[model samples]
Target chain A: MFEHFPQRVLVNEVVTRDGFQSEAEFVPTATKIELINALSTQGLNKIEVTSFVSPRAVPNLRDAEEVVTALNRNTDTTYVALVPNERGCGRALALDLDEINLVMSVSETHNLANMRMTCAQSLDQFARISAMTAGSAMRLNGSLATAFGCPFEGLQTEDTVLHYIEAYLEQGLHSITLADTTGMAVPNQVYSLCRAVRARWPDLEVTLHFHNTRGLGLSNVLAALAAGMNQFDASLGGLGGCPFAPGATGNICTEDLVHMLAEMQLDCGVDLAGLLTQSRQLEAIVGHPLPGQINKAGLRTDTRPVPESVTQLRQSLEA
Target chain B: MFEHFPQRVLVNEVVTRDGFQSEAEFVPTATKIELINALSTQGLNKIEVTSFVSPRAVPNLRDAEEVVTALNRNTDTTYVALVPNERGCGRALALDLDEINLVMSVSETHNLANMRMTCAQSLDQFARISAMTAGSAMRLNGSLATAFGCPFEGLQTEDTVLHYIEAYLEQGLHSITLADTTGMAVPNQVYSLCRAVRARWPDLEVTLHFHNTRGLGLSNVLAALAAGMNQFDASLGGLGGCPFAPGATGNICTEDLVHMLAEMQLDCGVDLAGLLTQSRQLEAIVGHPLPGQINKAGLRTDTRPVPESVTQLRQSLEA
Candidate 1:
């Protein structure tokens, strides 16, 4: 039981990278930069500016360098980027970025499907990349994807998932996260796995990356919190997904996360209203509506009373 | 902290009653009956059938009596209903109700705004209703609305909110719930308040009602659970809210909740697929796009790989 955690939650903004990457239309580099800049002012600690994957693989993120390079970094904020392999890691390193998130799936089927390699091969590659980044000030987050459940495989067992963690930890990747890549995780699974992982690696910093797939993402986060895990990965407006993964919808919306955290009286440090404002801007830029609920319905304090006309209309209908 | 909770989570389905009441559409009595019948088969333990409030007050739920009368009673499920006054209570008593939920607001302003009564007056009315059903087998749940914060008063103090609970317990209401009527609760507040309430009424059945108004509904529930509180009220597809409470978005979606609990290996007794099916039916009946996410995004196990055409198109666009 997390009897005493810092009464604060961290909102990692991934709108620019994750939100935009999933869009069919390419968001202009300038708009992406503007989004990041707007997010920085909104009191977010980390903004996933872009992914360093090959432009051919992910066309939307071709301007990763420009996006990261152009960000107005607040001293308190950290700028992170997702890197797939050595080539991508090299690009992240060249930027002297605040953090580099290296991701791989725990399930072999997803691992092979996602990264074109088996678990062992991906771990070996991670080990090589870990060795390359040794002694660097830039932080590295080794992310275990499909840690919850997999598309190809039914349920991801803890033993198989934790086996991957052993490799990452052995490689000196101290900070890591277990992602519900396809949003297959539930609260009990999160509780048991997080508890088991925490018991094994007490010193390791664990972040949870959840998708609102199946709509249990935030509940899974709560389960993790109960199991003593604090750090979480969320995208603004609940954006982002693996284009290859079917129905791998949006991430846990950032504003929703912060709004919940703030209401829970946790000091997430992110500005709730400002995030809502930025989320509105995000929706405007995207042209299509984002999935976040808080932005659509303003906070409680701002609610205007239902006008008498609407009330009378409702009343007459009821009559 | 919640090490002793039943591994199986209890999902109280409030859709037929709570969900439909929030919408302007007057769901037909037959449709409501069909909706509940569909939900009962979906592994839901407790499904709130309808509200017995005066037809004049809530035209949407005017058919509550007929809907409850039409339910298939063979299933080992608790069919509950919301009773607002002695008249509603009398109507519920006529039926074979398993449980009756008596609703009230904690904040004075909302109490007046919602029920046209002062807190004292509402409690007095509750006392009369309690007296009327004193010896009945039906379970009574004393629900304290705006327990976390109120739309009218802005931020509600814990002291003020708990005072209402103290009053309800005084009136012999043992099963009670603290509701975030406007989604004003943060996690720490939820944890601390749940702990405090538990400390006072150790035997009180504490159920939490959270709104996703600011997107903190599940997070708040998580905090309460961490504080060793269980039993939550959720609507299907995140449906239901105070139509009177502007900006009050949706209830914590039931499918979303069950998805989280079951995924955590905590049994919610809800057939995930069954719940989704019912949710789909409800959406079709409403004839509007539902706010639910999981239904549109197929299960996480559904990895039919994004079509080759999409990948090729995406790749060509990138090129």
Candidate 2:
């Protein structure tokens, strides 16, 4: 199993977008830019800066353009933004972003509830956006939300998920992400679906987006890794969730994911200590505790001095 | 990977001893018995009822005798207790315990810190206890703490861990548990160790005890399951930790573990709903928020009514 894992994995930090979008309080644009800048210095290859969505729908990311435009762009980091539709794409095109992530739910019920559109309508919208971005330097990545399971529709069949993947490929989207938007994925389901996807599209750059809602986030990551997945989307401090999806919780924490990968000796490029520092900063900015464990527990390398009581007890026992 | 897992697994609840010991307040003896009685009804095959230790060492469990004697034991549940020395074994022997679990740290540093004894002395004490229990009806089991890693000693080599296993076997104890006492076991390490143990002792009843301190508890369970481990130790609400190990946290939550197993279609012979209910009751008794995710998120089977906004949005889209 150890030999089966990739020697190095790609971690795409989505804190600025996915981590902040669910915040009830609108995070300051300067703070968002500072986070992005801090993350860029930590050697993160990809940072999702913000989402270009209707302010009424997601007011937290209303200043998406300002956040993206104000970034001290690091040449080494690929800046990405979430684009919900062609309008969002138009807004993203006005800025300098390395990638535009387009998302749609695989379940029609979720799609209707979240986007006020059917799955087919969402696909049509994605096609329009894909065409609009054709020949542009910005990369287009499609995310199939609720691909594993949905709260409203229950478990999704492999065929249902495969259909959306096929549609994304047909739209000429080379980068696709399978998202467990409702935190309903198990390791077996993750492994089986990822294996099937890898078998069909051997060259596709597949990424996984998992929620720690039910506490199986890291397990699903390990499952996907076993299934040959190399790219994953994680939020700093385990922030963000789907506003429309009932019971949806935070995404897998970027620091926690990096900590686990580092412990496993898998190279993830991003510095774990730097990521933890950012998690602390985000926690302070959010004005509450964040869900990431490493930030609270400290790293395994952290060796605290032995307490005096224990030393005294040992000495007493020796005597 | 799913095919590699057993069709059914065994879940042993250890909230009484492992979970309650770490509580800052002593849960009332009557409440402890009530919780144990409730857990018994949940179809859990085994429950670690309490630890037989000095009151000075663990004042929380000072009423171990009272609690065990008052339990409304279910015929279907096997009651177990943690015994640290010969005196503990004597106390457990007086009760109608189904098993006595003897614990010692594999790391000399941790053994000195936690048990106030060296590894050799602890082994000798376990031997004396084993002798006292010879020809008794109750089963004797040994748990090697810090089997995965130690806070004071770092990662224990496989040879050192295997040596402790050999010593336990020589003590005429076939029922053995390997514990990640400090939550330091990664999936690869768990897989490798479980695989090695299974290969060495085909018929040995091996149980794994994991802590979720680093948020890899369930992932380690998945890894162990893939390596053919069938039995695990979990607490009701992710309670319990080693007071001696810095950064040590809760044991894997029984409800969360069962939820993951049921979602994966693996049978653990435990009712998740019943466990969740008991977790709620335990939470109220503890007077604080517990770490179990299922208690807060509700089970996946729990389907919430669709929000009115989603219905209105769908109707408007149709119009």
Top candidate when judged by TM-score against the true structure: 2
Chain B TM-score by candidate, in order shown: 0.91, 0.96
Q: For model 2, how does the per-residue alpha-carbon lDDT over A116-226 read when each residue is reduced to its tens digit?
A: 788888888888888888888879899999898878877889999898999988887869999998788889899999999999988899999999888899999999999
A278 Cα displacement, candidate 2 (Å): 0.8
TM-score of chain A of each: 0.91, 0.96
* Best-matching candidate per DockQ: 2
Tens digit of lDDT per residue, candidate 1, span A160-231? 878888888887676888888777776767888998998998888788889876666777777777677778
User: Listing every candidate in turn, what is its Cα RMSD in Å to the true structure after a full C-alpha superposition?
Assistant: 5.4, 1.8
Consecutive 10-residue window with the lowest summed lDDT within model 2 chain B: B240-249
Give the whole-model CA lDDT for all candidates, comma-separated: 0.77, 0.86
Provide the lDDT at A173 for model 1.
77
Give per-model TM-scores.
0.86, 0.97
DockQ, all candidates in order: 0.31, 0.53
lDDT of 2 at A159: 95
The clash numbers for all candidates, in the given order, read 13, 0
Error of 1 at A305 (Å): 7.7
